[model samples]
Target: MVDLLKPYLDLRDAEVETDFGIDDPVVYGSRAAIESIFTNLIVNSLRAFAQDYSSGRLESAEVCFRKIIIRTKKLGDRVIITFSDSGPGIREISIDDIWIVGRSTTPKGSGLGLCIVRDTVEDMGGAIRAEAHGELGGAEFTIELPLRN
Candidate 1:
């Protein structure tokens, strides 16, 4: 999935970091849904960075790798996947309302991606949380999915 979005990543001078471990949880769900979860977040990060660049925010900011990091770890019967970026964090929208349809911080966003992400996670017996500024100093999304196969 990361490889598939290389164009977008390269356009924004960013990349993804992660190592799929042998213990990574595997849940039973639609393949497309799983793919959507990742693609949406990556695209969101790209859009956010693009906005910052156009507004001269990134150019003035300190230099960094500008990456998206995805890490997974098994905790009891669930796997916690943290997906984060190194761009300007979520802006404007409250963390509480970020997953709400039509609530968007990006100027051109349709405001539906995160909503679908929330619904899809819930439908798959998973839970998700978002942090505007997280460990990586940008938008962070932590999704916990059941370890059951």
Candidate 2:
């Protein structure tokens, strides 16, 4: 799967960071569905933060920022992965309908990003949630999948 996202990581205008807490992991869970989840979140983050890069704001030494962060860790019997962005805090006002199929707030593509994300996670017997990006100032997605025995 790393082959798919390698190009995105090299974008001169993008800044990404990842941290994994599970080192030399046990075979606790399969990361199959994670690809879709990561793709959707990363695409959204790129779109959201593109403005800063294109507008030349990212080069300013005054403000240091990371456009995206992905992290995974094991907690008890579950594996949690989080994707966060530094765009605009999730449009909570629009979130009521965010997951509805074909509901795209932006005029870009079919607004099925979150919908697909939710479905993929649930199909794996996992759960996902959306929230304010907290200090990151954009959106945060947290997914918790049960560890496969």
Write model 2 residue lDDT over 1-149, tens digit each, in one string: 53577688565355677788865333333466667777887887676565445556466552346467778899998888888877765553465676777775344647688888888888877888877554477788888887765
The total number of steric clashes, by the backbone 3 Å criterion, in model 2 comes to: 0
Model 1: CA > 4 A from native: 22-24, 60-64
lDDT of each: 0.83, 0.70
Specify the poorest-scoring 10-residue window by lDDT in model 1.
56-65
Top TM-score: which candidate number? 1
After superposition on all C-alphas, the RMSD of every candidate to the true structure, in Å, is: 1.8, 3.4
| Cand. 2 TM to true fold | 0.78
In candidate 1, position 97 carries an lDDT of 88
TM, every model: 0.90, 0.78
Candidate 2 regions exceeding 4 Å error are 1-3, 24-32, 51-66
